[model samples]
Target: MALKRPLSQHAQIIFRAGVESVCGDRLIRDTVQFGPTEIWFAEHCVDRQAIDRIILVGAGKASGAMAVGMIERYQADAASAGLIQFAGHLNVPQGCERIPEHLSWPDDLTLFAARPAGVNEPTSLAIEGTDRILHWVSEATPRDLVVVLISGGGSALLVRPADGLTLADQLQVVRQLSGGGADITQLNTVRKHLSAVKGGRLAAACRHAPMISLVLSDVLGDPLDLIASGPTVADHSTPHDALEILNRFDPERSISSAVYECLNQAEQQMLAPEAMSNVTNLVIGNNAVAVDAAGIAAESLGYNHVMQSARRSEGTAEEVGRHLADMTVEMLRRDPSRHHQDALITGGEPVVRLIETSRRGKGGRNQQLVLAAYERLLELDTSEPIDFDRLVILSGGTDGEDGPTDAAGAWIDGEVHRRARHLSLNAADFLRRNDAYSFFEQAGGLLMTGPTGTNVCDIRISLVDRLN
Candidate 1:
């Protein structure tokens, strides 16, 4: 008899390994090209004669680094040109300013301060400084090309209320939609309509000036409008769309007073002479690039497997897990003479909404995904007699962190739950509390990769091979 190899087991390991490799510092550097400083120099010096001045204004998570990079390049180039004494220093990019501290206006010209801890951390932006970021963007002028260096957090950071809206009103709307389980597209649709810079309004500001946008997209499909709320891109969202999202997901929450007024004002502006005229935005990088880079590494390592489905995935984390699990089993059964070294990879972000009264558990979406796959595997075992020992299921966030948990994600064999039972921890109980972190820790299934600077949604890889 030919040897019977476990297809799922190998697939799981290969996928996890791919994700870890891509999320590392090395890959991140190769993938997200054009440091802020580098782009600044390139953009400014592109046509020294035609463009009188290369004004640089950088923003987003990478702004600090981008500014620094641009400044260095400018200094080097000016030195080569024999211009010994340029007006600006070389240590930092000229025209690039550090992100301003949070500025909230209480009166016409008076402002209040609300700087919090973890100012640059993910949760910190989600909590504070969102509106301030928008105010800064809104302050840009027509003399500027408005080169926006956008990354993942741009959406939250580019927080501005539509005309007549207060910071509190914007925050309330954002909190309700985000906390209510609205998907990214839907959440951004609302964000675009409620902001001065988002959804092409910022682009509209420079109706007569040239504009260039270099975006590092965190959205699954690299949707331009959704990334950083599409500040430099035209918005397809309308006030109606924004209202629809709020009504569909958060009808109970009263619209903040500021929010209501902003919507009303935007209605009038749509009738204005110029809404979208001088905006050109480009998504220079995204999760797909990361996924492709990871896939290439896998192929180079001799995996030699074509991705089964590269389509961006949606729905809940559990649903994605169930679907992936079923797909893995189906692939193994259908391809009898399949090659010994084949794998399947998929990338996308999945949503997980917590109920109001339900306490969030320790794990992020990745752990939950693995758990869901395990349940599907168990169902398969119970419904019919089959060998599952060789199969593996793996899922993880590409950012290397999930839902405040120490572990990035998990890897599991068919015996995962069985082993968990052996350790006296109920798999279902842990999952019920949204605590995949505990379950995986006990089962020795958690995978850790600290602080992968790149954010590329989620990556799922499955490897299956026939026995020799």
Candidate 2:
């Protein structure tokens, strides 16, 4: 059964199909398999007799599913090898195990509910979980195989403050950087310097053990050292880089004194070079994976699909929205015959620079983008001869959570302006207040999808259909 709303139903189907394509479980299954004499994963093969133990240590929004996938793959091989001993410790967002149809793993793997589901901030609980993971990694020997699952949100899910820093201090720094609109790279640079587990420290703890990190990339460009703050990968960023980001984004210097001191100390005593001789980091899933899947799905629905590379998804939310709307208008004009269906798919996370207001409103980056697009469409000259009903635009966070709102994102068509007028709502006023949630709620445009158990950033789609 489809959702009663036609536009929403179509958008939901396309987006869900895209997300499912890069799910940790599916990626793991495709990358790992067991042969009669060797265990094969990606391009690497391990002789069954050469490994003494399998140790699983990871933290992220998708790590739980990744852990489950690994366990299932190995369990299937247990009958041939006779009881493969494995111990796992993973830090996952709370309630991840509750995802519908999520597979259950063996009792040997211990799952830690690190951060509260839907909230991306680090907490004391996440710190404890990171400690446990570190302990497990430290116990690994050269004969053991260490598998690390790193994905989006791992930075927060596996929180461990550096020496002389408290969790509260780190939280304050994160809150400031996030509210000030610092990009992922900037935020992670600061986080890596201030954390005990990030910036390849986790890899250092593994000592001489052979380690493989299967990562789901949420950062644009799929920078291995930036995803999840690169806990198991070598970091190229320096302490001065973190200090620069903090100073540039936090002009007021309102960051706690302890954080300032930490950065200052880090400038002189930065983390040592990571040992990479024994580590292999593989990016198994990324925004491109999801975007390509979405393009295929759109084509299957009889739409001519054009995809924007994952790198093109960057920019401010409003600017990105206007760009998509303008692109749609141009496409319709070129196809005056209106005899074909077209879909444009894009992937990347856009920033939302919150406006300063006495009263703050609720909304996320995706909602803001759709709202801005609606406004841009309304301002287009009527002489453009574009039929609004035949076009629909959607932007959503692939993780099923956008910003601080429960909604993944929002969708809009030509009718949004008329509906807003009937309600006597000024779209500009809502946009100024950064309250796309209320505007969409009244206009029937919000797209709500609870935690999707994965994160690869955001996806946007614009569909134009032939006039009837």
Candidate 3:
């Protein structure tokens, strides 16, 4: 008989399987290819003979690996070597800017650090890099085949504040909106209005060049126009849309005066959405892909798995966490030890409305989520004592960084809860202050995986052990 692995180990394996499936480099290899006759971008094919230059520009965490994959793909096809010139720029988070030594890292293609390692906001470096990309794209002609690699974090990684609005002003608007509980779409709607390069402007600048955008979606339902603020896809949203979101979030009229001025200008200056450039946007990977991959991994691990990838927002982090905890409880109620096959996998982006307090603790959405789940277990109203030894429940960001913390997210089990009880920690106290990282630190369940080099939002796993 085989020794059954720990349920925690099984849960991680399933989660990692999902992350690895939609890895930027792996997705690039799977979706892009070079041929002697033509180049393939997903289902679309382009005649190689007609293209003279391949301009590569991207912004996001996964772009470095995508650049590496592009280089590898180009190398693998010895037949097409040196037939066309390849050059461009990429704006990535700090650590993702560097390529592995194993690949032929080219000088012509620039990989720039757009933001600090832990901070996920637009920075001066991001603006400079965006400048380079705009310049590079503007230089492209009809002979150039432009490829834009877009993924999560691209919105912050790619930034050029609109005229008359300083970076601080734009950042302030975003900060106010985020603290007010604005969803990703609403936030990005505002982002598109505040930026010079975002919202299809990047592609529109090089309207003469045929552009292909490879999108790795972190947003729910893969709305191409909203992902990474839709640099390559046209924005159908009006400036009125942005102002409406601001008014909804900041009803007190506290947003920067410059932001309001900029939006008013954009309403008059911005062209009709239909008048923008034509670019083919291809969604190469997303949360659904990750969720499906995780289900396969569970099946391979000999567990009966059920999967769900959220098509819409799943509400607050605490709410989603409690739901997962309830799911685990319902599954446990069925007494799965006799059958030995129960695994639940879910994927989606959850909102984290930060508590406004100077005493607030540090944590990302994933950590907050798991902490909520732990609280739910403690609150369960059951006559019989719940079994803690046979369960593993976890949530983590696919990019391996959750919120502003170093942790990808966090996990919880009966053993971890016991440790918390022994430490005399109050989960509710921490939960109210938005500090799950502190609770998990003392409880021994913080999931720390630095920068997975890919982002497809978040994945959660629930696993139960089998009787041998």
Using lDDT as the measure, the top candidate is 3
By lDDT, highest first, what's the ranking?
Answer: 3, 2, 1
lDDT of 2 by residue, 1-468 (tens): 222235545666788888898888778878887665777779887776767778898988888878777777766666665555678789888777542244445566787888876688998889888888999888888778899999899999888898889988999898787777778888898999998889998998888688889999999998988999999877889888888998898888888878878877876655566465678888888998898998988877777888975563377888889998998777666664644677889888888887654666988899999888887887874656556776788999888887777788999875665587689888788888889999989988778877676789988988876644
Against the hidden true structure, what lDDT does model 1 obtain?
A: 0.56
How does candidate 3 fare on TM-score? 0.96
Q: What is each predicted model's overall lDDT from 0 to 1?
A: 0.56, 0.81, 0.86
Once fitted onto the true fold, the runs of candidate 1 whose alpha carbons sit more than 4 angstroms away are: 1-45, 49-146, 163-171, 204-209, 254-258, 270-278, 308-313, 334-337, 384-389, 414-418, 465-468
For candidate 2, the TM-score is 0.93
TM of each candidate vs. truth:
0.73, 0.93, 0.96
Residues 348-428 of candidate 3 have per-residue lDDT tens digits of: 988888888697798989999999988888888355566777678899999988888888988987668789989999999
- RMSD after Cα superposition, model 1: 7.5
Better of 2 and 3 by TM-score: 3
The candidate that achieves the highest TM-score relative to the unseen native structure? 3
In model 3, what lDDT does residue 288 have? 96
